[model samples]
Target: MGERLAGTVADAREAAPAAPAVLRVIIDAKRFPALGEAPPRHVLGPLRLTLRAHEVLVVTGPSGCGKTTLLNLVAGLDDELDGRIERPGQGRLAYVFQEPRLLPWRTVAQNLALVLPAGPDRAARIAKALAEVGLAEAATTYASRLSLGMARRVALARAFVVEPDLLLLDEPFASLDRATAQRLRLLLLDLLETRRAAALFVTHDLEEAVMLGDRLVVLTASPASVATELPIALDPAARRDEAAVAARTAELRGALRDLGSLP
Candidate 1:
């Protein structure tokens, strides 16, 4: 009986489909042009990374390590760099910046509607997204009136409303208070689990990276490259455990310190 069960499990594993590759980034080099008397600033590369569907890859590095530049490259906001980014088909990409980046004059629902296509179901989509982020009643509220935490929630709602294939988060929870940030992190985890979208999240917080990433990539100092890539084995429930998260964070920090990537 035990042998039969083991064979069944192995067969199931073999039958399961592999996760599709969602994004491929190959950057041979990235440099900022010289200004007047200064030389060109070498910022990043010789970096290659892949993001797969239903995966969250968090990138952590020292300050001024060109992390944001990498995001810009992936988003196609800057195409002058040495390498190329490849994505399967024309998939929608959503981004949540450090700042809310909402239009102060527009209501929360209107802000979301801007990204969504004009359709009869747009209102429903907006409402559902707002509710998912715990902001149901704030749909009609103007972005200018929201507190910092609330505004960040709206930003998240806006991102998810589009049903993106890939999500890019750049320190989305950075400036919030501890409690608020924790709440947002939980909310984000729930959304990611439900949506199963690929994500590339960037942050300096080691704990946040440990709690949220399916895999974590550590980068070097200026002209950043991959220092190490650590696959997180923690389940979703384990991520919510403060002690577990802290231990993982410490371990990651130690590895980075050993490599001289972190101080």
Candidate 2:
């Protein structure tokens, strides 16, 4: 790869706080149930999260550990969730799920248009977003015609067009190959720097966490709680070596090995 997208940057050097909203999540012992079972079980945050405005907070955990559930609660997607989730004001939020969730019937441009304000500026903004993801040539293409990675780029465009105050991502690159994932990782960092959106990202990859996260928060095995908050110690201009991204991948993997649920 050319260079690690995030480069070696001090975690403290992340974008300056811009959003006025202070986001707090307080869940007192959450419970849910087996997927096919009648009774529910809770495995997510019972603890609280106080995300100081204008920062990226990443949740890294194994599959089935309720990373998505915790994210949903914070996004108000699961209103059935009973918990105190607070925010500054009517701040806008954008969610990028594990799947692209693009509409098959819509063209890339139209799909992107859904997230922008309904006005004359919307179309141009959508086009710009698609270009940012290097999908300008696919503007009129239908979702069904795109590859998984392309579909994901479309999703990224959609999520970013709104210029949301809070951006929530759920394993957005989980299905892509390593090279493709790394490329998008760079794009995401560039976007984060420019958009300055407060982000809550959930991923299982330790390398990804150390690479992108300002503060890496790990959840315990089922019935999750914040188990670790590993702050990255790279420079903003951090790059990779031929061996790997700064050769920190193995060290990060080792750190996560200590987490019993790490895959």
Candidate 3:
């Protein structure tokens, strides 16, 4: 009788459906129309990618390879592309652009509040997000007064406060000093650990890519397409080790070299 019951349970599990992808991108092509003396330019070739829940997919490639354009397309900021973007269900999304892009006139708390709907719990939510990013004391600080690093932290807090299902980050660490950038990266990893949201990150830094990405998507030059997809299997704890990260970076560079996509 026990054996029969076990067989029935196994059969039920086998019959269950698999979960759908959080997002799927199938971009056939993207082009810019002629302007004055400039002729039409193709920015992206056929490309396909998918994002699964709690995954961090980093997109990196040569300069002018349409990495930003790809992110914009996935974020639904562009509709001129040839193919379609499939998001399975109605889910909240957030974007942290290259620049902090905070309104200088607003306070840090106010900045986070803009993304959230007004309610009695709004203030508490803002406080919790700020605290997670180590900016609890900066709640009332004006965006204009905070330094670049602080501003980036505030932007990150804003993205997380809404509890997005998908988070899109475009070079969030660009232009910061190494120490500051490292700090922010670590903070981001910690937050993602707790939140477990699917993230699509774009960056030019190989080291940063090696440290944060679960999978790296390398693209070809202008009129970009997928050159290769490299899965990074380094243990999460190893991401902090210089030797581990350097080894992985070297491996990635070699892969790019083989594809002739190295920048």
Candidate 4:
């Protein structure tokens, strides 16, 4: 198992291209309209960051700290903010939101087929993605009929099927049960091992950040900005072990506590 994992990591390193920048964010400032009869409130600003190829950057901060807002800007979902975001012009992007956001009326396979381009092997691709997430048997099942965990798996499959250049995840496992979340996390790690993409995952869970991130970027309470950036030096295989995860989690917690951001 160890040798296999080492080989996988090596393959990933080789597959990853030498890109100067996959994503860049330069935010001079950001603000939002306040409640009725109030002035605009600051949200986030004066921040600059870059994501390289095949990197997983995790963002963690208190609730309402503009984490989602930052992702929106990167995804080009929101242009009402004060920021300049850059992404590779020819790159494809995929996003996994907190909610599964699947088409309830469609079957699992049909939902995945929506984003995939028409091709001779489209069906095969869909099947393979479902198998990856342990949902091959659920392909014909209606998305609305599946449990929350299954639904999330389908969502993940949809994202991976597109084979995006930049992947954005906004608390994809936020409301899942502990066991389900852990399983999905492993699935995510496995998928990332084979797929080379720059990913930005936003979550409030410190443990999740330490487990999934190449580097963790802690943000301020509100009007979020980078607080501290910590590189996770553990090997990908070691990070899966309980002891290693615990140690890394503790280290991240201490860092957050010192910044007064740990809840």
Per-model TM-score, in order, reads 0.91, 0.85, 0.90, 0.88
When sorted by TM-score, best at the front, the candidate numbers are 1, 3, 4, 2
Candidate 3 backbone overlaps, count: 0
User: Ranking under lDDT, best-scoring first?
Assistant: 1, 3, 4, 2
1-263 per-residue lDDT for model 4 (tens digits): 99999999999999986766889899988787787899888889777889988899988888898888888888888877676898856488999987899999999999999999899999999999999999989999998899999999999999999998889999999889999999999899888878987899998887887788888888887877888888975688876887888898998788778977673
lDDT of 1 by residue, 147-244 (tens): 99999999999999999999999999988999999999999999998998899999888888888899989888889999888887689888999899
For residue 213, model 2's alpha carbon misses the true position, in angstroms, by 0.8
lDDT of 4 at 77: 84
- Per-model tally of clashing residue pairs: 0, 19, 0, 1
In angstroms, the error of model 1 at 101 is 0.6
Which candidate ranks first by lDDT, i.e. highest? 1
Task: Candidate 4: list runs displaced more than 4 Å.
Answer: 1-19, 33-39
RMSD of each: 3.8, 8.4, 4.0, 7.6
Residue range with the least summed lDDT across 10 consecutive positions in model 2: 1-10
| Local distance difference test, candidate 2 | 0.79
Model 1, residue 55: displacement in angstroms? Answer: 0.9
Clashing pairs in 3: none
lDDT of each: 0.91, 0.79, 0.90, 0.87
